[model samples]
Every structure is written in C-alpha cells, then in structure tokens.
Target: MIQQGISPRPEAQIFDADTHLGSNTFSIGPSRTSDGSTFLAVNSHQPWEGAVTWYEAHFHSEQGLDMTGGLFPGSPMILVGHNRNLRWSFTVNHPDLVDTYVLEINPDNPNQYLFNGEWLDLEVRQAPIKVKLLGNLSWTVKQEVLWSVYGPVVRQDHGTYAIRYAGMGLVDIWEQVYRLNKATNFKEWQSAMRQGGFASFNVGYADREGNIYYLYNADLPIRTEGYDWSLYLPGDTSETLWTQYLPFDDLPQVLNPAAGFTQNSNSSPFQTTLDPDNPHPDDYSPTLGIETQMSNRALRALELLGSDESITFEEFILYKYDMTYWADSDVPRMVQMILDAPTPQDADLLDGIEILRDWDYDADPESIGATIAILTLYDLARTSKSFLGSRLVGGEFTSEEVLDSYQRTVESMLEHFGRVDVPWGDINRLIRGNVDLGLGGGPDLLHAVGG
Candidate 1:
C-alpha cells in the first residue's frame, strides 16, 4: 500500500477549506444558439495569487497534441481548455471521497492496532523535512510517519485515526490530461474520461459537431449501506473498509440534453439542466455524499440560460457577465432577514439597513447596497466557519449572528470610509502591476470575485 504523507495535527484543527475552490462552466449546443453554432464559457474562480493560481499556456506536439488552456505551475498538461474538435472546462465538485476511521489501539502495544480479530502492527517510517532559517541557514527535521491498513495514521490524545481518500496512490492524472488534450471527437474524449484518472470535477464539454455534455465525474468508493459514511467509522472491522470504486458509467452525466444547455457552478449535480433532463438524486446512492445545494451562480445560470431558447453569442457573453443575484438566492434572503429583525437604535445601523432595503440585488460598480452586503458577508465568512460553509451548502443562520455581522459591517464602514453608502467598485478593487481597476461582482455571482 502507498503511504500518504499527512502532517499530524489535532482533529479540531482540521477544517473545511474547499469552499474557496469555486468555478463556473457552461456549454450551449446548436439547438440553443441563434446561428446553430456551439458555445462554451470556461470560467474558473481562483485566488489571484497563490500556488493554485491559473497560468495560461498553449501546448503543441508532433504526436497530435495541440491545445491551449490554463494549468497550475508544474502541471504537465492543460487541466481545462479546448482542443480543435471540442472544448471542455472543469468546475470543482464535492463528493464524499475521504473517510476517517477511529482505530482501536492494542492496550499493550502502541504500534499495534486491532483489526478484525488480530492485532496488526502499523507501518512506521521517518520522513525528513528541511526548514529554512535565516538567509542561508536551514535545519533538517525527521518526523515519524505511520501507516495503517486503512491508510495514513494520526495519533491524537483521545485515540488513533486513519484517513482513506480517493486517488491515494494513483499517478495517471497527467496521462489522462494528455489523452484528453489529443482527443479529436466525443467518443475519444469519453474514452479518455472512462480511464477514471480524475478523482473529482464537474466537466462541461461543447464540440464543433454540436454536441454538449456535462458529467459529475468522481471516483466514488462503493461504500456499503447501513452506515453513516459522513461520520467516523469503526476501524476495528474490515466491513467498514471500502476497496472498490463505482464504475465510470455509474457516475451522473448528461449527454446532449434536449434542454440545449448544461451548467455547473459548484452546485448540485441533480440540477445541471432542465427538469426533465437533469439527473435524479434518487438514482444515486446516499453514501456518495453528493451535494444538494444550489449556489447563487447556478441559480442565475438556470434563470438566464434556461429561459432563453435561441441565445446569440453576444447574449451568451452578456449572460456570463451577469452581476445580479437571483431573487430566491441566499443573498436576498439574508438581506430580508436583516430587514425583518428588530430595528436597531443606532443611526449608522439604521442607515445601513435602509441602504440594503431600498437597493436592488445587483453587484454593479455603482451599487451602494452591494458594497455593504458584500463586505459584511465576506467579513462574516472570514470569521465564522458556519457562515463560510453555509454559503455553499445552504445552511441556516441565527438572527443574532446575522444582526451581529451587520452591526460589525456598520462599524467597519464608519472606521474605514466614514460612511456606509460607498460604491461597490470603490471598495472592491482589482489591483495589479500599474493597473488598479474597479470590479463589479461579489462572491458567488455569475461574475464572481473572492471578496
């Protein structure tokens, strides 16, 4: 078994950081376009500067590989982009691929754990890590790493835990990207996907031949029923150990839906397209842990693209740049919650609430309401774990928390700008080398921003 390198830390320290990895992708087939031409918008939202930031490049080879797209540093092939025959983009998808097991350690031996009816010894190794100290000084530190039958092991004060995740030892991801880069047709592209190299991503594809596809691709483990996979499993039993993955064909996918378009904004897979064509949530196993929440971006996409029968290229581009949050989205709902709360006596808080009440739900640069809403929500997301996770998963928030966040927003605005009626663009800016531009969109909108 391959040993996964995991740093030992307290269980409480492990938090959900995947909410920031958001992307938006959509494909329109010939039936949905005015000129009978296919359209694809490959938009991925990522940090402006980081290790995971995107770098655009073009790759060509005499071996029939010619593609242009974005990739991270050190990536051998383009992760999402278009070849000559077809274009595809990737949006991050959340599936229950990782599981934690609470191990029953042997009473007498710290290096042994109970498995089935036997006490099995753990695989231990020393991992050397280099640390940089001053300018030219460094230190080498050796850390003890342990591996159990389930996977990497971490010993805590309470008990020992093992982590098992998809693509634990798989190394063919680059090869799969290479194959996707060279595929000339839908059949070839589907064959490449069938290789099952990608662990998680919602793929959006549009071809020159008028074919469009959306796939909720994941290497979901064939977990047994009758157990809550979301909770920690009993490590002492082999029955909780899953060793097989669901087949590629078993995954949720849509090919050339009659609705004429497909979209994913890190939302639920069951609502990828129109009602009759979308994948049913009941068709999949509950152990898959598929997301059932609809993001604001996804809701806007459905509202814009679904209502249009023949979309022109210009209209498609305009829709992609949509800055309005849907009426039923969480943003409007949260705004209402604030309005319905008990009226605050403070003048600044009252003004802030009025600004939000009278303002339209558009994230335009000139919108003053968006300035307050986005800043307040973004601050809440940074400080509260529940708020951050709930933004994507559709979790509930208490009135106290919402009112407190608004109060903080008023204080912050007064401290920084001396007013709460500042324009959205003035507060939300995109600064680069010699170019500081005003931005129009807030988080989770069609034209999304991290702020």
Candidate 2:
C-alpha cells in the first residue's frame, strides 16, 4: 500500500519503549530451560505495581486510586522508573508469527485423517463462549474444537488446518521482565532480550547512562522454505511445519542512532527515523509485513516532538492535550475538498457552504461555523461510506449533495440543541474519574477527537 504523505515523526530519546511493570503478588517466576538457563518473566497478576510505584514515589500520590487490574487476564505490562539504570517502552508488533493449514480428510472415515498415507484420529473438544447483555441476561455458545500434532485446528467450509503462534504451549514471558527490571547496563538488557521468551512487541529503552536502543522483540518462527503462510498453505506438506525461530540479533533494530531519536506512531519502519538515520527497508522480509498507516495522533506527535529542542515536562503534557487541526490531516482535507468545489444553485446549500468555508477549523462548542462544517462532513461520511455506497452516491458527493448534507446536518443540530450556537466543548467531551469536562481539539489535532 502507498504511504500517506502526512508528515511528522516523533524521535524522542526514550528511556524505555515497552516494559510491563511486574506485580510482586500475582506474578509467576521463570522456569528452568532445557539448557538450564531461566526464561524471562515480565508479566504479573498485579498490574498496579508500576502505576502505584510511579504515582507514590514520584508524584507523591496514593497508589490504589489509579490502579486498574490487568487489562487482559493473562497479559500484563507496565512502564516506570527513570535514569540510566532503568527506562523502557513498547509498541504492538503485528508479525505473521502464527500459521494454520487445512488437512485433507478421508472421505470414507470421518474420524481418521490421512497424512503421508498414514491415518490419525482427529482430537476433538468443545469450546464454550459466554455472552452477556442486560442485567442477568446471559447465554452460552458452544463450538467444536479440533487439535492436531501441531496445535489447534480451525475447521471451516473450505477445509481444516492446524494453527500455531509464537510460544503457543511453551515458555512464560515474565521471566524476561524480571531480568530487565534488574538490568543495569546494555549488556544485561541484551542478555534479557536474547532469552527470546517474548511473543510480540517493538521495544525501546534508554538508561541514565545516556544509552538508547530499539528492538523488534519476539520469537518469530523460521518456517521451512516454499510455504505461503500469508494465505492458508496446503497443510499436508510437512515443509510447512517450522521448528525454529530467527535469532534475536537477526531482527531489525537501531542503537544510539546518529539522528538522536527514533519514533514510530504505528507507521512503517521506512519512516521510523530521520532521513539520515532511518533503517534500511530492504533489511526486513515482505512476509513479515509492517504497518504504514499514518494516524492523526502520530502526525501531531511528530510535528511537535521532532523539532523541539529544549522541551519541558509542562510543554510535553500540554502537547498531549493539544486539539488543533493541521492543514494536511485527512479530516481537514475532506472538508477542504468540499469547500473548494464549485457552488450549487440551492439557497440552503450555498448558505451551508458559505458557513463551512468560513469555519476556523476549531470544534469549539461556541463556533457555530465549525459545528455546521463538521455536521456536514459527518453527513458526507455517513452517506458516502455507510448508508450509501460510492456507486449509489455517484462516485463522490456533488456540490449539490455537499450543500444538502450541510443543510440537513445544521438543521438537525439546531433542532436537537434548540440553537446552532452551542460551544464546541458542549459537544466534545472527555469523561474521566467523576469528571465530565469540556475539551479542545477537533477530530484531527494532536489531542485529536471531539466528544
């Protein structure tokens, strides 16, 4: 896919990219490996350790108030501490670390499956999923589950294949987390990563020693040659079964980059760093596809974090709450495209366009102009992508349709609010901790999103 032209790349010298704060109470320690070395263990049952430690030690705030137990039942991660001795951060790593293959079944015997002229009984089990809606309203859905030598098998109309992912049955990852928590230097951290128990993530670390590093941390499988796992490959082929993983050193990474910063707002590696310090794209395989989407949040981060030199914590926090639209953002462009088009004959439509063109791009509750413009844009999106297909909408909105949507949306807002002059804050809200406060920034700003 083509990369979006939205520019901005956050290249801060981060101390830590990803680290799950270890919970002392609920965490399971590492087990002995075959070679006798212990595996990494970063996850813990207690998810509040990091947040509590940070709030109490640094901010002098109480711990239990901000803690939300582990977001996921089994997966736990956190980031805290400071200086050369400790720092870490993480990003989601979407690698094709898993695979599934359909096995050819015997037509004569349903219980027996043929593999390499040998027959084996399909392992069967039942999986029950719970569904809950209103109070005391709940139901269960049961599904037939299959298992093979490789792992679980997902049967569908097409066929059945075994499925596998990194660390499917073996290894507890928290062991590595424990090691990193105590690591005091690059070598110790390197040794932690070398353990290779982690399933997935992009990591960045910095220490009080002034050293910085970025790594794609995971146990990515080293599949046998000539298998297209991108789509389901023929499961009958034994070659599809991968027995090894690429070494941690073989993964893409950068250390102490001359550019002084590394940033990835979920975009491709091609643009992770400044021009002179960016990683070579050819280094990674196409099979391990990377993301290239540019989110408005990332774009805004790059705009400020990239160019700022003597940044302060106050400025940083303020930047996080910035809610202004950049001219290059996707939402603004859609609005602009409509505005620059030729005018239509409908009086209501022309009046709407006049209001939209006059908008200052602020979603502030008091800005009637902004309210009309955004309502019109929302209507356009609803008609173009949801209620009406592109064909039904005639490719894109005509100047007349733009006017109509503008008129209708404005009418609805007036009817609902009893006035068209409501403040932007009245519509865009950020609710948190008994606070339903009004906020700034529209749909495409740094603190992006209204309401």
lDDT of 1 by residue, 281-318 (tens): 99989988888878888989999999999999999999
The per-model lDDT (C-alpha) reads 0.86, 0.54
lDDT of 1: 0.86
Q: Which residue runs does candidate 1 get wrong by more than 4 Å?
A: 1-18, 128-141, 342-350, 382-385, 389-393
Worst 10 residues of 2 by lDDT: 23-32
How high is each candidate's TM-score? 0.91, 0.67
Q: For residues 9-83, write the lDDT of model 2, one tens digit per residue.
A: 123111122211111100001111122221111222122234432321221124211211122333343233332
